[model samples]
Target: MNARIRGIFEDAGVRGWMHAVSLDEPEASVELDADAVVPMASVYKLPLLAGFCRLVDLGELDPRERVTLEPSARTAGPTGLSAFADPVTLSLRDLALSMATVSDNASADALLDIVGLRRLAEILESFGLRRTWVRRGTAANLRDLQRRTGVDDPDAALAVLADNDRTDPVGVYEAANASAASARDLTLLLRRLWAGELLSASQTEFVKTTMHRQVFLNRLASGFPHDGVRVAGKTGTFGALRHEAGVVTLPGGAAFAIAVFTHAARGDFRQPRVDAAIGEAARVAVDVLR
Candidate 1:
């Protein structure tokens, strides 16, 4: 398993680590410097969503409650709520869907505002995520936006990110303000969710289903066939750092959580090797469980 995973990383020119864990056997797990902290990139959104759900659970916010998106609230890029017709109005449920399904920055920022980052931090503490730090800044979502713009430039793209400093006050964030997570904790989070210990089964199912909509699959999801093997994950990338972490459910109800972080050559965040390493690590978890 290590050899296969190593080959994938070597092929991708990724310099980092991989961790794997199987749900069928709680005591068994794999680590490759899994304790190391790494920037979360957009993977921070999972905690954000979990925090929002906690709010809903507490009756502080209503999932069906309607909210407005002011022009000022309108940040741009792959987000549904942000790019929707100006002054868009939607329920919290819709907004969360937009944020998770597309990694929508506007939806994320709005939710962060509603949920509050400090409270989110507290929630992570309760969940036992020590290194994961999404605190507060600008275009922290830049990796995705940058990739999108480089491939799909527009008249309004560059200026928006250039003004990312406005994101915190205006509701954007830089990667630094976001928290970091280790490969091990990330896998533990996934394993717990799949085992129905992270949240209520319904809540866990919501997260798992929501993550399945991730449109960008060049990383971990690219490693395995989408059929019998299911990869439900969140990805994070900044500069040359590439990270993808989540649960992989294989045939016969076995599941494993794996997180892979890679440092790559400039402009190689999308390299296939890093992605393959993530896949191989997940495959290892499945093998162990079987």
Candidate 2:
């Protein structure tokens, strides 16, 4: 199973790590380079959401509290509230929903400001995820990208990333300031969440439901199309990195937490093969545990 999974990544021309563990029996698991640190991209939103939910649970935050954001206040992104031209008012709960469901940069930045990086760090520590963290918010990440590449435009920065001969890819990747995690740590986090160890039962259900509403499905979900199986996933993509982490639940109440992180050999932004490999690799890992 490990060789087959490694072959999927090799065939896709990318470095990959994966871990899948059965929720019904956590001892049943599969892994490959699961402890290697990798860029998490937008996958940080998962922990951010958990932190925000924790605040709500502690009575420290009012989910119904309304905030108005101008168009300029939003982080630069292609989707959701970030793409809007007019000022918008939203409840804190809706902002989190937008962040989780649509990967809304604007909403994420807003929530991060409210939750604060210190609080997020505390949340990860509480969950025993020593290697996972949010170094900075999305806006800071984009600014760092421009600063490091000497390119004011995102497209130009991406072009710099694509030129391996002229640029140090590792330096560029580090400059992105994305969240970081390992497959083992992420999978363990999910397993604990599913086991009701990270959050209360109701809050855990909220997190799972938010993940279930994710609109992006080209990665892990593509591999498991069985009608009886339900996937609740979060996807992250930046530069040559693509990742998806989530729980797949079978009809008989059996579930597995899977995390697949990959970095392509080339910097093409639209690599369907890499995306397919993510799903295929995750499917193989899940099958082994099943």
Candidate 3:
């Protein structure tokens, strides 16, 4: 089964790491380099969201507390409050929603500021997710990229990382310098999440609902496009890496928590084959677990 999954990844021009376990029967699983730590990219928001919801449940933070994000204070990104010219005010819960559904960096960093990075690390440690580490939010990551490349412009620094001739000084593709996680750890987190062990019932539902509403579905959702088969996933991308980790629920009620992380052989911006391979590999893993 591992060999078959690897073949799918190779055919798609990427190296893959995956872990899938039956939520209904946790004993059943499939893994391929699932324990190796790799960069989390936007998927770092997963644990961030968890910590946010946990705080809300604990009453340490109010979900409905509204805050206005000035343009200068917001992190630049392609979506959400970052794209808005005027100052935008929203409740903390709505910010979390935007972060999860659209991978909004501005919303994520804002939430990170509210929920300290140290607290997130503490939360993961408490959960016994030792191999998963979220070192910083997206803004910090981009800043490091700029500093590493000695480029003032974020986009130019990103392009330098994309250049095959240059070795990435920021090491964004590796586990150490950025937020990183093992597939096993991520799947375990998801298992507990789906089991309502991570947050209050309402908060768990909020996280699940937010993830289910993710706008980008070409990766994991492509494999489970059949009617009534719902996929609640979060995708991560950085340079050559592309990943999606989430729970897949079948129409018959069987569910699996799967995490598929890949690094492509090439650095092309658009790799539809790699994206589809994520879904296809996930389908295969889920089928085996089923």
lDDT of 1 by residue, 53-88 (tens): 767777788989988888675655545665677687
Error of 3 at 215 (Å): 0.8
lDDT score, residue 92, model 2?
A: 97
By descending lDDT, how would the candidates be arranged? 3, 2, 1
Order of candidate numbers by TM-score, starting with the best? 3, 2, 1
**Candidate 3 residue lDDT tens string, 1-290:** 99899999989989899999999888889999989998989999999999899989889999999989999988888788888899999999999999999999899999999999898888888777989999988899888878877999877877876777767664556678889999999999999999999899999999999999999889988998896989999999877889999989999989999999999877766789999999999999988988
Q: Which segments of candidate 3 are over 4 A away from where they belong?
A: 164-170
> lDDT of each prediction vs. the true structure?
0.68, 0.85, 0.90
Clashing pairs in 3: none
* Clashes within 3 Å, all models in order: 11, 0, 0
- lDDT score, candidate 1: 0.68
- Cα TM-score per model: 0.80, 0.95, 0.96
**For model 3, the run of ten residues with the poorest summed lDDT:** 165-174
Q: Candidate 1, 177: how far from true, in Å?
A: 5.1
Evaluated at residue 101, the lDDT of candidate 1 is: 73
Kindly report which residue stretches of model 2 are placed more than 4 angstroms away from their true locations once superposed: 162-170, 175-177
Q: Which candidate wins on lDDT?
A: 3
